[model samples]
Target: MWLMWIYRILILNHEISMASIEPIILGLEGTAHTAGVAVIKGREVIVNESATYFPPQGGIHPREAAIFLAKEFPILIDKVFKRLPFKIDKIDGIAFSQGPGLGPCLRTTATVARAISLRLNIPLLGVNHCIAHVELGRTVTPVDDPLVLYVSGGNTQLITFLNGRYRVLGETLDIAIGNALDTLGREMNLPHPGGPHIEKQAQSGNKLLTLPYTIKGMSFSFSGMVTAAKKLLHDHSIPDVCYSFQEYTFAILAEATERALSCTKKPSVLLTGGVAANAHLQTIIQKVAQEQDTSFQAVPRNLAGDNGVMIAFAGTHLFNTGKILSVEDSQVKPRWRTDQVQVGWIE
Candidate 1:
């Protein structure tokens, strides 16, 4: 009991000190198709701008997306500076998404971050992309400690903070939920970022065709569902397939989330990442939270998808904790896992 009391006191002190000082940080995020730049003075986002690359056909091509990000980053940075009332030199640090992303994209963004860090003679902080999503969700919402449902294009996991780290309680065994949706969308001749398109079609769909619902313990798999959905195209209506795809996949996610919540018993549940913007998934997870009698909040639509603001916010926390990185040591990790990062900024 004494140890717990001391820990709470330390956390309170940290919060107070952080609230007293507002440091300016410039953050860059180019993990995949989006190239984003933003500046933040503490929690207030000064300017956040991003450009997404949409292939003419098919999913993201790493080389092509890297080229697109490299081209747009300068413009986005310029836009951010122009929108700021103060000079760019006021920034105290530069933060970039270090990894768990495509190699080319991560390198492109890291190069820009390093250049700016050296140019300004400021500290550089490498942030984990997955942790940034959870931090961003926490920043924009009222939930202090919550079970995080991070669903995106390349990754899906249920995360919660414990032992000074974000622990993964559950994750996808095969392709991520977003990837499955996009793949099915492509097979249907839909445009890129199939989540929105699928959601639209699913609204008109009254029937739910059977699709694979693979969940073992806390982990789930979407590969089977994607394959089955594609074959269902031959005999089933597009709306029905889309609706069924969402129902089965989202139900699997909701069940897993609920199970983790039951075990962790976090105060709330946070639905983040690009796929979190889907209303159907939000509804399903919200219902789960309701049944558990816990609060639920989804990241705002503006911050739901990948953005530089998340990097800046999380970077600010890391910077305050003195987790600076040297240019020579700022190498990107394509397979960096969330559990590998120590949450020094948090308890």
Candidate 2:
């Protein structure tokens, strides 16, 4: 009887200690080309690990990408737990990128996340991928309630927190800007991943080639611009085409983002996602945001791309606001829309 009472007292004290400690969340990111794992306690990310796979040629094959993610995710899982840096297990939740991504990759990631959640018997959260990018920017920067510009390989949009959701004021009607850039890189046969090469070669560009620029209201189209730029290869130099391509695309995106700023009446502008890391695009958006008298925030280079940190950070907020998902309800949302998710995390 004495030993049992002692054990009960110790267990109760341990629970009280955990209650005094800030909660933590482990996030799984398997949205597209990257498979990542992150651990965050409160607002700080203590572990952010990821592995990326870029195809040797052409666009990403969904099944192949999914296979690669499946292989790498287990490795990442091992590394994350091995390097936790602490013994505290206050892992209050498990969050995963639940939608708006390649179907195969999304499913693969969700499967792993569900296994972890079930094994731990904790609440799970299904987070929107694009919204994760935006939240990560806000978390790592000094901006609050900014007009968010998210540009990644699979997405492009201008969003802001308004009313009760992340409102999309503008977006790509055709191809995402990052996709367009990578496609142009492929056409030139410069490299498998062409974004940086395009930027480097564009530095020597002395002239701008005339390219198609399509915009309808707040939405823009990059397919026509990419096609037009590709056609210029025979007539114009690669450097010139690349320069003009960046110029035209950046201009249109800047225009749309500018429109969102005015309409949203936001106090700051934050840029995030993989394509937001481009030096040229950063320059363009920074100038635009400053011109409008709104502060601009660029997510740190490391956190800008698709990573698990964003998922965990966003998930923590959602979990605190009473969001929970059962095992059966934790399915992947391959085409989940950002605006469709009820934003209970942010005020």
Candidate 3:
């Protein structure tokens, strides 16, 4: 009893009171391509977490993704808080990507976020995952009212938001650019993750090989390009084919983005997604934007990849806009639309 009293006294003496936190936000990302989580104190991100799960086959497996998240979620969050380099008590709220992604994967992320919010007794905010990427990329860029072109493993398209609604200016009529690159890489017996490998090989490649550079009006098609490139492999070097393919496909994207700027009367362009890490793609887009006399915005290489920081940043934006999600709003919809967001996001 004497020892227990002494321990209690020490604990009480060490306990410190905290001030009211000024809206620290946490963001959850478990969409189609990457599973991640992030913590933000106002505009600055304290901790951003992400993990990659590559399937044995070509694409993502929902069941396997859920299993990976179940294990990684707690560890990542613990690592975040433990290594926070700042006060943990200042975290004010929670934010998460609510929809338009894989159902099983999103459920795993949402379950974790909901539990965290309950434990902290903080408000939970729902953010659109795509919009978060756009906002974060824009914040880091010098573009103002720019036409945005977002291309990733799961998404590929041209977009412009007008009057708080994101309008699809043009998009892939078939497979996404990354999807096509991955398929081509698999055919060439490359690694599981194909984008970087293909980009590396393209450096030595010549544009002698011919690939289908299909562009129909504002929309584009990469399926035909993948097929054509595979056929050329028998006659041309892999590097040559890869180079030609990059040139052909990125040209489509650049042309579409440029056209969007002209139509919207905006001389700025923002690029995001995993594919944005490609130096060739960035150079091409920069050249196009420069030729058109428009501003170009591409997030840093670290930020471009799917990470928790973007999610947390996105969630904080939602919280400030009064877009909180209720306890009953836990349903995970895999195919949520971007324009379906009714809340006032941008002015």
**Can you give the TM-score per candidate against the true fold?**
0.94, 0.93, 0.89
Question: Clash number for every model?
Answer: 0, 0, 2
lDDT of candidate 3 over 1-347, digit per residue (tens): 99999999877656421212235777778775567877876556677878888877766677887888888888888888887776665666677777767788788888988898888777777777777777777666666667778888877878777877777789898888888899899889888678899899999986666666688777899998898899989988888888888889999998887777777876778889889989989998888789788888887888886777787777766666777787688677677766676636577
In candidate 1, stretches whose alpha carbon ends up further than 4 angstroms from where it belongs are 1-20
TM-score-better candidate, 1 vs 2: 1
Which candidate tops TM-score?
A: 1
The list of candidate 3 runs beyond 4 A from truth reads 1-22, 85-89
Candidate rank order under lDDT: 1, 2, 3
lDDT of each: 0.93, 0.87, 0.78
Candidates 1 and 2 compared by lDDT, better number: 1
Q: Measured by TM-score, how close is model 3 to the native structure?
A: 0.89
Q: What is the C-alpha RMSD of each candidate to the true structure, in Å?
A: 6.8, 2.9, 6.4
Task: Give the alpha carbon lDDT tens digit for every residue of 1-347 in model 2.
Answer: 99999999999999866643556889999988899999998778888899999887787899999999999999999899888987535678889999989999999999998988888787898889999998888878989999999998899998888889998888999889888998999999987567778888889997978887788888998988888888999888999989999989899999998888888789999999998778888999999998889998899888878999999988877787868888788778887888997898676
